[model samples]
Target: MSSSESQDETHLTPSALGTKAHWDSLYALELTNHSSNPSDIGTVWFSDSDCESRIYQYLTSDDLSLSPTTTFLDVGTGNGHLLFSLLEDGDFEGDGMVGVDYSEGSVELAKNIAEQTPNAEGVKFIRLDIIKSSTELDFFGSRIAEEGGFDVILDKGTFDAISLSDEMLDDGSGRRIYEVYPEKVAKWLKPEGGIMLITSCNWTEDELVKKMTSSNSGLEKMGRVKYPEFTFGGKKGSTVCTVAFRRKA
Candidate 1:
C-alpha cells in the first residue's frame, strides 16, 4: 500500500467521487509495461482464481447481456482490458459498451486498444470518476428497469481501491466495500441482472456471501450460494476471489 495521499472520509465515501490527481497518478504508468505478459492482464497480476471466475461469468453467463444486442457499463475501468478481453473471448455483440474511469490516461489507453479490434468499436472509455459521477445510475437504473434491464454489470476492483484509503472503511468511513458496494450494485442491476465481483482482499467467498445476504438474516435462510461456475487453478494455488451475484428473482 502506498501512503502518499490522505482522504476526507466524511465527504469521500465509496459513493463519493475521486479527485483528479487521485486518478492521474494511477494512470501515469502503463499497465501493460509492468505485466510479464501484457496480453494476459490477469496472469501478470500473478493471480488465477479471481480472473478465472470473472472469465466464466462473462463467457458462460448473460451478465454482460451479450445477446448480439446488449449494452452495459464497466465501472472504474482501467485500460478497458476486461472489456477488450470480452470482445476477444465472448465473441458477443451489444448495442454498445462504455468504460468510465477517473484517469484520463487510462480512458485514452482503453480507446487506443479498442481501435485495434473491430468488435470493440462501441467500447468507449469515459474519463470520469465513479465516486464523483455515479449520478447517471439514477437515469440508467430506471431505463434498465423499464426496458427489461441490463443483463450484466461487472466490477473487478473499483470498490477494492476505495477500501485502500483512510479510515472510512479502515476506520469509520463506515463498512467494508464487500458490504456496501453490493447494495449499490444491486440498485444498478436490472432486476434479473447479474453482478460478478472479483477481489484480492482478505474476504472469502463465504464471508462475501454473508455480507451480500440479507443482513441480520438467519442461517437457515443463508443467501443461496452458487457453486463456482468457473474454476481456474493456475500455478498459484490460492489468489483472488471472484464472487458472482445474481439479482434475486
Candidate 2:
C-alpha cells in the first residue's frame, strides 16, 4: 500500500480533514502505493466486506429493485471499491455508474483502479467539490442534470466528512454544507423513486433521518440497515450505520 494509505492510523482535526489539500495528499500517497502494488485497493471509509455486504443486501432486498437501465451515482467514491463490488459481485447491470470526489488524487486513484478492473469498464470518475454551493460551483451539478440525473446516489462517508469539517460554515451565520447536502442531492436524483443511500460513522440513524426529512429537502426516509451492536457504559450503539432515503414523487 502507499505509505500514506498504510494500515498505520493517525489522528487529524476536522479543520485539517475538511480541506481539499488533506484528501489530495492522502490520495497522492495512495496512488504511489497503488503503482507499486496495483492489487492493493484502499478503503478510506470502512472495511470492504462491511460496505459490500450491506450495500449488496440492500440492493437485492425487496425494498429496492434494479433494472438493466437504472443509473447510479456514488458521491465521494474513495477507491471506487463500492462500485466495483456492485458490478463484479452484486449482479448490478445498470445503465451507468459514476463516482465523484473533491480530491483530484482520489478521482485519479479511482480511475486507475477502474482501468485495471475488467468489471469496471465504463465506470466514470470525476473530480468535484460537492460541498460547494451550486450557485458558486455549478459545473458538477449541471453536468449531472444534463446527464438525466441518477436513479440511485450512494454516499458512504461524504456527509460525515462535511459534518466533521471546520469549513462547513464560512461564516458562523451561514448554512453548513452538511445542512445543504440532502437538498443538493435531491437535485441530482430522479424524482418519484430516486434513492439515496448513506453509510456513516458519525451520526445515528435517527439523526440522518431527520436531516433527510428537513424542510425543502424533498426526501423521505425509507429505512436503515442494522449493524453489529456494542454496549458501552450501559448504552447500546454501533460504530457505523447505513440509511436510505427516497425523493418525493
Candidate 3:
C-alpha cells in the first residue's frame, strides 16, 4: 500500500473537538453552570442514542458475571457521567470506580458533580493525559497499581476524539497519536481477565474491532453492546457501536 493510503486508513481528519482547548473551554462553562444548577451536568455525548443505558445494561448482564466489587476506569471521562450512571443504575460499587481526563476543567467539573451526587463519595476523578502519561499510569492509586490493573476500562467517545486529532507521536516513527492509543491504554487492563469496552460514533463496528485488536494491543474481541440496526440504501448499520475486548491469554 502507498504511504497516503496507509495514512488515510490510520488517521481521521483533525477537528476542534480533538483539541484540549475545546473541552477546557466547554467544561469551564459547564462548571459555572453547574454551580448555580446542580442538575446541569454538561453534555452526555450520544445521549440521544441512549448509549449510556445500553452500556450499563451490557455490563450488568449475566453473561459478564461482573460483581459490585469489580474495579473500573473511565478514560476521557467528561463530566464522569458514565461512571456516575453506572453507580446510580447498576449494582456496581463506587469505591472501585475512577475517572480520568486530560483537561483540568473536566476533572474539576466531574469532582464537583460527584460531591453533589448521592453514593458518589468513593468515585475519584483525576487529571491525566493518557497519551502523554503512558509511562506514568501508576498515578491511578496504590490499590489499582498494586492490583496490577483495573478489571474493566471504558472509553465512551474518547478514542473518537483522539482519532480526530492530527498530532503525531514524537518518537520519530511518523505514526499519528491515535495509532498508538490502543497499545498505550491496553496496558492498564489486568492480564488475567481484564476487559475494555469502547463506544464510538466515528468508526463502524468492524473498524472498531480492527483498531482494538491490532497486533500490538494484546486484546481480542470478547463481545459487543447491541444497538438497533437500521437499513439505509440496503446497508445495515447503527449510528454508534460499542465493542468489548479482553487481553489475549
Which candidate achieves the best TM-score against the true structure?
A: 3
lDDT of 1 by residue, 43-88 (tens): 1231244463355454455434446555566767777766666676
Give the runs in model 2 whose Cα sits over 4 Å from its true position. 1-13, 133-148, 168-173
Q: Which of candidates 1 and 3 reaches a greater TM-score?
A: 3
Off by over 4 Å in 3: 1-10
Better of 1 and 2 by TM-score: 2
Model 1, runs deviating above 4 Å: 1-23, 31-54, 61-66, 138-149, 167-179, 214-237
lDDT per residue as tens, model 2, 1-249: 442342213222466656677788889899999999998777656674386678778887766767655678888888988888788764675237888888888888999988888767778888777757462223435544655568789999788887767554465434445666777777787776788899987778777777667546799888787678889999888888898888777
Backbone clashes, each candidate: 6, 0, 0
In what order do the candidates fall by TM-score, top score first? 3, 2, 1
Per-model RMSD to reference: 8.5, 8.2, 2.1
Worst 10 residues of 3 by lDDT: 1-10
Best by lDDT: 3
- The TM-score, computed over Cα atoms with residue i paired to residue i, of candidate 3 is 0.95
Error of 1 at 86 (Å): 0.9
Report the lDDT of model 3 for residue 200: 96
Over 71-138, each residue of candidate 3 has an lDDT whose tens digit, in order, gives 99999999999999999865999998989999999999999999988889999998889888855446
What TM-score goes with each of the models? 0.63, 0.84, 0.95
